[model samples]
Every structure is written in C-alpha cells, then in structure tokens.
Target: MSHPILTEKTVLLNANVKNKEEAVRLAGQLLVDQGCVEPSYIDRMLEREQSLSTYIGNSVAIPHGTEKGKKNILRSGISILQIPGGVDFGDGQMAKILIGIAGKGNEHMEILSKIALVCAEEENVSKMIHARSKGELFSLFDGVN
Candidate 1:
C-alpha cells in the first residue's frame, strides 16, 4: 500500500512557523501523517539541515531525510507547506515554501529534478507562496513530471 508522491492532503497552505526548525518539523510531519515515512525520519530531516542547508534560492526550502534515514521511508511521497509569513533559514535566507520529501530508492533523484524544474521559475515560487488554498498550491505541482 504505497501512497502517491504528492497529494492534496499533503499540501498545507497559510502555515505560520516561528523558525526553520519548526517549519521543517511541520513539513516532515505531513509526510508522517500521510504514512510516507516513519516517525524517526523527522529527526533525520533535522540532522540533514544541520549538516547542510536545504534552502534553495527564491524563498523555497526542500527538506528531506539523510541517507541513513531512507530506510525509514515507507514509500515515496512529498509534502508541501506554504508559509506566507516566511521563516528564516539563517544567513539571510527566508523560505516561504517548504517541501518535505521521502523517496524509496532512487525515486528521490527524479522527485528532486521534477521539483527543481517547477521551482526554477521565480514566478512559480511566488505563486506557491501566496496560494490561497491547498488546491491552489497542489495544482502548481500538477503535471510536474
């Protein structure tokens, strides 16, 4: 019983978090709630962040588990959290969009590339940040590949 990579149920809109850690937790928790990964995966996500920032340019951050954490994944999935207010990712990086991913095997590379293509355009990132509803946010990733 594997879940879809991304689903409307996993898209959260208008989220408000005090910091990047909290934001990451919310994003990772969505994956957990959707049964994409085990509870331990969230800790690994934080560990990854500590080692290297996942904050890509254009006010977006993609957080995922470390290599060892992959074993905790139940299936491939993505969870999106839109924070209109934004959270600080340190070193002057503020991320309004948080994408948490859990990929089985090499699916993560595909997922990362797909997400990169969609997020390459600044306008798309802006639209995602200001999305009024979960459907709006979810639709932005539709047909992403």
Candidate 2:
C-alpha cells in the first residue's frame, strides 16, 4: 500500500517557474520557505540534478534522492509549477508539473508512487494543470488511493 506524501495543500498549481533548473531550485526554496527542509538541502538536490535529468515521462518530473542519513526520514513535498514555455526534461517533452520528492531511505517511494499514479491520470493531470489555488490543488489529490 502507498501513502501520499504530497497533499494538494502543498501543491502550487501553474506556478510561474520556467526551465528544469528553476523548477528544482523553486521546489527546494518552497521546501525551505515553508520550513519543511534545511537550506543546505537545495544544494544536495542541485548536485543530484547536475548528474542527471530527473525528468520522468508523462510530462511529469519527479526530482528526488536520499538524504545524508542512515535512518528513514519522511520529508516529502509537492509543487505544481506551470512552465509556460515548457522546460526540457531531456526526454523531448516539456515539463509543466514539477513534483519534488525528498527524503531518506525507501519509505518515501510509496508516496512517490501515489503521486506518479495520480499524475499519470489524464483527467487528474488536466485538472492539476488548471488548478488555481493550493486548496484546489489539494482537492485534486483528494481520495487518491
């Protein structure tokens, strides 16, 4: 069974973010701005992105990796950034939704999988892209099982 780490409440729909680098940076900043993560966390994420493009298929890109901890840490967040020009995901697809998942160990995968499933849905994706507020974004994720 998978749990949702990213609730719609945390999602920012149609964000003005543009480009992959900006998307990752914005996601990290949101985490810090919301007091959900440490400032240094962004650097770690940037390092990871430099290694490879974290853009997955389906116009969705999940940029995440394990933190520097031995045990599991359940720190996860989601932000829906709408790139009007579309960011290159290295897969020849422009990404509009940036789902950032950060944590330690494997527990976060469950939530990540849930986000993946929700994003994979055509109806959900359209609604998510058109989402207006944090509340509406959260509503899209409601009852997602």
Candidate 3:
C-alpha cells in the first residue's frame, strides 16, 4: 500500500468538539471519511487515551497510535480541535487544540517533529484555534512545505 503524508489526507472542518474524547472521535471520523481508517479506529484511540494522556504541553496534545495494520493505516491528521472547557493535560495546562496524527514505522517521529515545530509557534497555534474552516486550516500549512 502507498503511505502518504498528512497533506494527502482530508481534514474535518468546523469540528465543534468540546473535549478530548469528542476531538479524537472527530479526527477518527475524518480518517474514515478519507478512507484512511476504519470506524472502530475511534474507539481504539479512546482506549489508548484512557491508558495514558497524549497531551504534551502548551495547550497541545497528539493522541496517536497504530493498530494491527487494520483500521489505522493512514499517514497523519492535523485536527484543529477547540476544547470548550479545556482538558487537563497533567501539567497544569489545558489543551485547546489537538493534532491527531497516525502513521507507520519510523515515520511518526518526523511527522511529530513537524507538529512540534508548528506548535512551538504561538501565532500558528492561535490561528489554528481560531480557524473557521478546513480550508483555512489547510492554508496554515501552505508555507510549511
């Protein structure tokens, strides 16, 4: 199978998710819509979250993992989710946006580094949190190339 990058996947616009659970579900839905993953992928992702928190810091969380080469066989998904009340990130920080990425083998670190670079910029994070549509969010990565 051909493993593509995050840009090749479709994004979910106007994801009105309030918390981490809903955010993960929305991302999984996006993967499903893009024919990247199965419907059960969301449930598995949630289970992983329950096992351990994916939040890193600075209002960012990357809830990610790989399955038995089944549902989650995509590259990555940069889901710009808005946590209405914020979710505890285990470091006195509340996650405002989630960038859910799913890939294979050693490709995770590179994509994760890209995500980290994007999150390191406060301006970028702000723009993502306030993004009104998927088109706008996709535009954020325009210069990332």
Say which candidate scores most in lDDT.
1
Q: Local error of candidate 3 at 76, Å?
A: 4.7
Deviation in Å, model 3, residue 111 alpha carbon: 0.9
State how far residue 137 of model 1 sits from its true place (Å): 1.2
Clashing pairs in 1: none
Backbone clashes (count) for model 1? 0
User: In terms of TM-score, which candidate is stronger, 1 or 2?
Assistant: 1
Writing each residue's lDDT as its tens digit, candidate 2 over 1-145 gives 3434555444665566546777888876666555446667767667778787777666767776435521223354544555545678765777777776665455466767777778878787666666667776677666532
As for lDDT, the candidate ahead, 1 or 3, is 1
Ranking by TM-score: 1, 2, 3
Give the per-residue lDDT digits (tens) of candidate 3, residues 1-145: 6534444345544446556687777766666676656677677778778887888776778876545433455544444455545666555768777776665566667777877887888887777677776666677666433
Let me know the TM-score candidate 1 reaches against the reference structure: 0.96
- lDDT, candidate 1, 1-145, per-residue tens: 5456899888988898999999999999999998889999999999999999999989999999999999999989999989888899999899999999888898999999899888999989988988888878888788642
Tell me the spans in candidate 1 whose CA falls farther than 4 Å from its real position: none
Regions of candidate 3 where Cα sits further than 4 Å from its true position: 1-4, 7-9, 66-71, 74-78, 82-92, 143-145
Clashes per prediction?
0, 1, 0
